[model samples]
Each structure stands twice: as C-alpha cells, then as structure tokens.
Target: MAQVEITINSKNYRIACEDGQESRIASLAAMVDSHVKDLVEQIGQIGDTRLLVMASLLIADELVDLREIEREVSSEGGAAVPGDGEEKIVSALNAMAGRIESIADQLERA
Candidate 1:
C-alpha cells in the first residue's frame, strides 16, 4: 500500500491506495480538488462538507452524461464506441460519490 497526501479546498488529506495506484489516486484527487475549487468560486465557501457533497454530485452528473452518451452511441450502432476508459471513469465516479455520501452521513451524525 501507499499513502498520498492530497489537498482540496486548502485542506490536506492522507489517502491510502494500492502501491502502483498512487499516481492514479493523485490524478483523481487533483480532479476532485479542481471541482471543489470551482464550486467554491461559484458559491463561495459555504462549508467544506457541503462543498464536497456538491462537488461529488457535479462529478456524478458528468458520469451520468457519459453513460447516456455511451447508451446513445450503442443504440445508434456508431463506430465511435466508448472505450474501457469511460467505463473506468464511471466506476471511479460512482465509488467516489458513494464515499463522499458516506462521509457526509457520518459528519451529520457527529
């Protein structure tokens, strides 16, 4: 296992990942950080937990869009079929959303 320190909304978090997945995890974290920052810009710093939940929803929306596109392409029998990367992205986004929601639930209970 490997630990990666990621910064989102000026706060740092230590995340553990498989040894070879450190870079992939870092990349995902960067994407998440960008979303959080963009959300902050649009809505101001409402709250970290709210910002994170909103960001997760926004990313999940993108995943939903991608899945819709994939479905349309498949229905049309288009040559430009979505690849494994899209599947991986959808999977990652789903997992991330689940984790974020879980954290939010825990925060609310505390």
Candidate 2:
C-alpha cells in the first residue's frame, strides 16, 4: 500500500491505497474539494467537518436525483437509440451515478 495526501475543504488527508492508485485517489480528492468549494462559496466559511458532511449530503442528493431521472427516462423509452441526445444523457448519467457511488463508498470507509 501507498499513502496519498489530498486536500479537501482546505484540510489535508493522508489516505492509504494500493500502489498505482494515486490518480484515482487524487481524482476523488478533487471531487470532494470541488463540492466543498461550492458549499463554501454559497454559505461562506462553515466549519470543516460540517462542510464535509453537507457536501456529502449534497452529493448524495445529486445521485438520487440523477437515478430518478434515469428511471423516468428509461420507463418512457427516452433513449431509444445510440448517438441520440437522450441516449448520451442517459449514458452520462449512468457513469456519473457509478462515480458517485464509488465516492460515497470510499467516504463511508474513510
């Protein structure tokens, strides 16, 4: 295992991961940081732990919203073929949900 240092909500974290997983860890950190930044920008200077918790909740809400939209679209046969805009949106939403799940799992483990 290797240690990766990441900064989120202006605080640094040292997380352990297997070798060759540095990029993935960094990517996860970036996402968290982005969320935290958004929260900070909106609310202006909250406690780090509270900000992190709020960020997680916001991310989870986003995932749930996307899943609902995906279900509705699928039920309505919105994406009927490849190359169509609806198909692309559905695909993107699926990928995003997968990423969000992975991030949530990681956060839970952390």
Candidate 3:
C-alpha cells in the first residue's frame, strides 16, 4: 500500500491506496476539495465537520440526479441518445458517483 496525502478545506489527510493508484486518489481528493472550496466561498467558513457534510450532500445530490437521468434515458430507449459519447459519459459519471459514495461512507466512519 502507498500513502497519499490529500488536502481538503486546507486540512491534510493521509490515506492508503494501492501503489499505482496514488494519482487516482489524488484526483478524487481534488474533486472533494473543489466542492469544499465552492461551499466555503458561497457560505464562508463553517466548521470543518459541517463543511464536509455539506460537500458530501452536494456530491450525493449530483449522484442522485445522474442516476435519475440514466434511468430516464434507459427507459426511453438508449438508441434515442443525443450524441455519440452520451453513453460513455453517463457510465463514467455513474462510476464517479459510486466512488463519491464510497468516500462519503469512509468519512462517516471516521
């Protein structure tokens, strides 16, 4: 395992990941940090725990919206897609949402 240092809301967290997945972990950390930063800018500094909860909710809400859109698309027949890469984009979005959910779960336990 390799340890990756991720900064979110200016706080550092050291997490372990597979050696080759350091970059991937960092990218996800960046995503979370971006959400936190946006919230901080819009609402000002609320405690770390509250900020993280809000960020998690924002990410989870996006996930729910994506899932709903995916179901609507599937039910309407995927052949009616708008563009060529829509399917790929949806798949990637869902995968990212799953990862976000996993991260949220880990945070809850922490």
Q: Give TM-scores for every candidate, taking all chains together and pairing residue i with residue i.
A: 0.70, 0.66, 0.71
What is the overall TM-score of model 1 with all chains considered together? 0.70
Give the least accurate 10-residue stretch of model 1, judged by summed lDDT: 79-88
The candidate that wins on lDDT is 3
| Colliding pairs, model 1 | none
Q: Each prediction's Cα RMSD?
A: 8.5, 8.9, 8.4
Candidate 2 segments exceeding 4 Å error: 81-110
What would you estimate as the lDDT of candidate 3?
Answer: 0.78
After TM-score superposition, the amount by which residue 41's alpha carbon in candidate 2 deviates from its true location, in angstroms, is 1.4
Encode model 1's per-residue lDDT on 1-110: one tens digit a residue. Answer: 79998889999999999888888988998999998886666557779898888788878877776777567666767635457556656676686666656745654564
Screening candidate 3 with a backbone cut-off below 3 angstroms (N, C-alpha, C), the clashing residue pairs are: none
What is candidate 3's lDDT per residue for 1-110, written digit by digit as tens?
89999999999999999999999999999998998887676556778998888788878877776777677778878748567347656676777657656755655565
Question: For all candidates, what are the clash counts?
Answer: 0, 0, 0
**What is the lDDT of every predicted structure here?**
0.75, 0.75, 0.78
Q: After superposition, how far is residue 101 of candidate 1 from its true place, in Å?
A: 22
Q: List runs of model 3 lying over 4 Å from the truth.
A: 79-110
Error of 3 at 11 (Å): 1.4
